[model samples]
Target: MTEKTAGKSLGVVGLAVFLSAALGYPVLIVAGRGLNPADGAVFLAFWGVVFGIGSALSPIEQEVSRLSAHADLRGGRVGPTALRTVAVAVIAVGVLGAVLALPPVAERIYSADDISLGLIALASSVAFALQFGTRGVLIGFREVKPYGGLLVTEAGVRILLLCALLVLGVTGLLPISVSVALGSFAFLPFLVKARKHVDFVGDAEPWSVVARRTLLLMLSAGLTASVLTGYPAVAKFFAAKEDLDALGSLFFALSLARVPLLLLSPVQAMAVPTVVRLLQDEDGHRRLVSLLIRGTLAAFVLAGLGGLAGWLIGPWGVRLLFGDQHVVAGWAVAGLVWSSVLLGAVLLLAAVLVARKQPGRVLLTWAVVAAMSVLVLAFTPGDMVLRSVFGLVVAPTVGVFVALGLVVRAGSRDTSVTG
Candidate 1:
């Protein structure tokens, strides 16, 4: 049992991830049908902003988890370091939320009386910051059950709250949105329960160095979040007024296409350890390249199949699941699906880069892909669906090429891999 900690933890956490992701679809559907088209779109946009903020702050969790694990291995304490980091992260996110709540931004994102909504967003951001931090502490200590419990707890809380609101005949956008923010507090129970037993003692790094590394991670993650979780908010900003009505359908299609990403994104974490092991070998570079080449080929084939299915049944499926108001074109759905799979491929390559300790390349990959994708969305001469398709497709395609180029260049430096 002791020897199986890694595998067991991963299995538990993986199931938790799957369940949390699976719950998201139903939550989206309930929210979509619960509100009118315009309100549903607004809710989604708000959802994106809040969750995007959370995603941007996710690096703290990663950093803390890594630090905690290293600290435990070294027989040090990480409690003080983790607490300080969490404090900084929460404060930073709070400031960001405040900026978003400023009259101009708030008005655009929420109702005319947007103070309440903005406050909700701010609260949610802080909650998510703490949630991530706590989970990091749990997982870093190899407390997989606790970590998994937190994930399920948060999802369950959100869904139950949403259902309760609906049952009580409260379907207002603001009210519905509260469920999301409040759900993040699910970590509190777990945190309190294990506080005394948890060992947070760990060696501390210099504050400046820690801060710098965290900022870089946040920047890279922010870019990725802007492309993934934040795209809905992007669409709301760039879309023409006439196309606004169809925003619900566009968002619905986007969510459906992203279902695969939820499952595949976790693969990046799994790949990191494997890649690190490979890097220790004499012919590691060659082996890594060969492995990725095969993986890329598999990604392409799977993406092609997913795209075809999206083209064939994507529209019908959305209509059946979300209703006529959420109708989108098949080709656009196909593009979205294809883009998602490609992004998964990019994630795999990113794992390699991360394992190789090449932060610069990782940022470069996201930078190029994210910028180009936004540019395509903003300037493409077409309807919303066409623009979205082009934008989504451009992200992962460009990302794949850029990441591959970087990987190959890195491989070139190794004597084991002659190009």
Candidate 2:
């Protein structure tokens, strides 16, 4: 089992690095164009929405699947039904956002948008939410090749579209946003084709029961999203009030630092179903949990080494990727990477909790973290970099450690009960 798990982990890791390179390079190029501090903030805000919605929807889908399984609904039908519901909700939100109420909200959040960025953000949000929910179905079915392929293809198409727009001198948030929506559209056919392989197209269970469970799951998932994406926005609040240049540097550093986490995502993706199955058997659960803790610790040590290397060589990398003018963002980049390692560990714990059906606990932990982040950002002063590092990194790191301890204790209690 260990050997098989290791082999699977290696394969997923390889796929992650491949996709990241394919996707990351183009994103870096697009990001390079936004050297202005305001542009940097906008870019971060766009991703904040995209990833925030994605993260928020993740565990909701998990809950949907769990409920569907319990109710004996077909896998194929369960996903499509939930996705259709979310897709409609997303579109409704977009349409409602067209009102003047949005600009004020954007302004309050320091995310001033021309009509184009707003519309683009709106469209991107719906597309992202739909794609994410469907992708969850694919993962639940264990259709990994198609799942990974869709991701790589989506990233490829996005890059192509973005590059085409840039070459035409139509570089702004609108075109990129449209490109994101289009890229999402490109994945629909693949999802349709993938759905044929899974049994997801039959009659679903009762909608009322499913809706009730999904809402609870949404709250949990939404809180997780807050920690992942809300932290950046919270940091942005403090960032905007301080030195703009420092804010830009922090954003750039943090963005670059996230690449390693992206590279590690496939591991977590595969880990989820694997852990879920392991938890069904007593000895298997114990073995799986032990391995996960050890594996996460090992990954962290490696990430720490990589972060140190980035700290040492990051300025040169930044210069090469962005420009010599942006070299000073390296230290923050290194710090951000180290923070991601911490975040990655927290994520692994979250996944374990989900597998154990304890997502509410995970949600509560994120609530505390998000609240702490807001407080720290609101109170901190001095350079934006220092403020951001403290609020986003220091506070979350503390929260994650506390969350990890709780999860470990919970797992132990669960084992005792089952034993």
TM-score of 1: 0.92
Best by TM-score: 1
Pairs that collide, model 2: 75-200, 76-199, 76-200, 77-200, 77-201
- Over 347-407, each residue of candidate 1 has an lDDT whose tens digit, in order, gives 8888788878788888888898889888997899978768877888988888998898889
TM-score of 2: 0.77
lDDT of each: 0.80, 0.61
Inter-residue clash pairs, candidate 1? 76-201, 76-202, 77-201, 77-202, 78-200, 78-201, 78-202, 79-200
For each candidate, give its TM-score against the true structure. 0.92, 0.77
Q: Per-residue lDDT for 105-215 in model 2, tens only?
A: 565444554455555556665676566566655555554566677678777788888878878987665566567556655457666754554345555546665555555
Best by lDDT: 1
Runs in model 1 lying further than 4 Å from the true structure: 74-76, 110-113, 197-204, 412-419
Candidate 2 yields a Cα-based lDDT of 0.61
The worst-scoring run of ten residues by lDDT in candidate 2 lies at 410-419
